[model samples]
Target: MQVDVAILIIIYAYVTTLVVLWFLMKVRPKFPSGISIGIVVFLGIATTMAVVTILEFAIAPVGRPASRVISIARGLKIAAIEETMKLIVAALGILIAKNEAKWVDTKLSLAFVSGFTFGITEALFYVARNSYSLFGLVNLFLSRLIHPVFTVSLVGGILLFRYGKRIEGVLVASYSYLGHALLDHYLTACACYISSAVILLALASFAGAVYLLMPKIEAERKQRGEFEKEATVELKDHWLNKM
Candidate 1:
């Protein structure tokens, strides 16, 4: 019982701290007013819950006592459902708020928050419904941590779309889904007493995902910086004219 409490506390603390930091440093200043930002945050959380519920129902048809091939297919299906829902939610959020101008600044941050919420919520749900030993708990924690990286690919797709590369954007976005499916495949393989070297493939895939995501983040950050500079100049001009 004590162990479970400690695990819960650790998970909560980690999640809360990351969220608070993102909100304060990344999200808060990007919006025009508190109310708008609140709406975005609320929608993100709601989207996470919706995704989790949908995934549970969607995967139920996969059933149990599966062969290795069937297990891998299930994993791919899970990845497809999750990544699709996330991408759709993020895209909808962008379209609904895209006219704000500030919406572009929040794109990456919002995606991160949504993905973070999804991963943590899904992890907690898994913890609640299953028993885990110490090693298993550690593995679960590590696995959940990587889950958010998939959103980085979504952001890349969004960026490309905004830049008028629709087809390329879609293919780039699907990268996350494929990466996620690969990780799930290896994990399922390991569970079935397959050679553990497959874990290396998972790690490599994660590293590759991160590598692919970095340039997109850098591009977004540079663009946001430019936007802030322009806004600052405009505000100064307005004050000077008023004077």
Candidate 2:
């Protein structure tokens, strides 16, 4: 049953990734290169492995204990580790891209992919460790979907930092970390009363980040189209001269 649960979540993640890619490609004229997307996905998986390793060794492992405080602490630790890893990997992905300006055009999508992959990887780990019913695993998968928001927030923050808005960058990044910690803490502690509030807040943040990125994405798309037009014109002139 647990194995079935894991398979189901994995299938869902795969389909979700493809759908997102298709949607972005349809709506945007410019997208990140395949290599850049590949790197981000690889980094996302590596980030998950790093987190699991640290949790298993460096951090005090949290078992199925009855203590709420311990559970909260575990959650905080998880947030700290996972957020740090996501930030690092996201930045690394940007750095690895050959054309930073081109990457900026589809930064949000790349960030989403990274976070989505990371979240799914983490969820699979939990699925392996625990025996969950089909419904329970589905719920877990849904909750894990919030992860892309955190990554998008972090990437936006990093962009702000690079563009000289250091304070705002820090604040935005802090917001992502805070939302992630709260969700994890409440979920792990089984504080049902507050979970709904936390989830709503996280969703709101996700919506805001996407809203903020949309204008920038459109602007970049226009700019890229103009650049392509100019390039085609130049190529045509060169061909005429050759003829």
The candidate maximizing lDDT is 2
For model 1, the stretches where C-alpha displacement exceeds 4 angstroms are 1-70, 99-105, 133-138, 161-171, 191-243
- Tell me each candidate's TM-score: 0.58, 0.76
TM-score of candidate 1 on Cα atoms, chains taken together: 0.58
Across residues 142-238, which tens digit of lDDT does each residue of candidate 2 receive? 6566677677777777776666767766767677878667665654454444655665555555455445555666777678789999999999999
RMSD of each: 7.4, 6.1
Pairs with backbone N, CA or C atoms under 3 Å apart (clashes), candidate 2: none
Q: Cα deviation of 39 in candidate 1 (Å)?
A: 4.6
Superposition-based RMSD of candidate 1 using all C-alpha atoms, in angstroms = 7.4
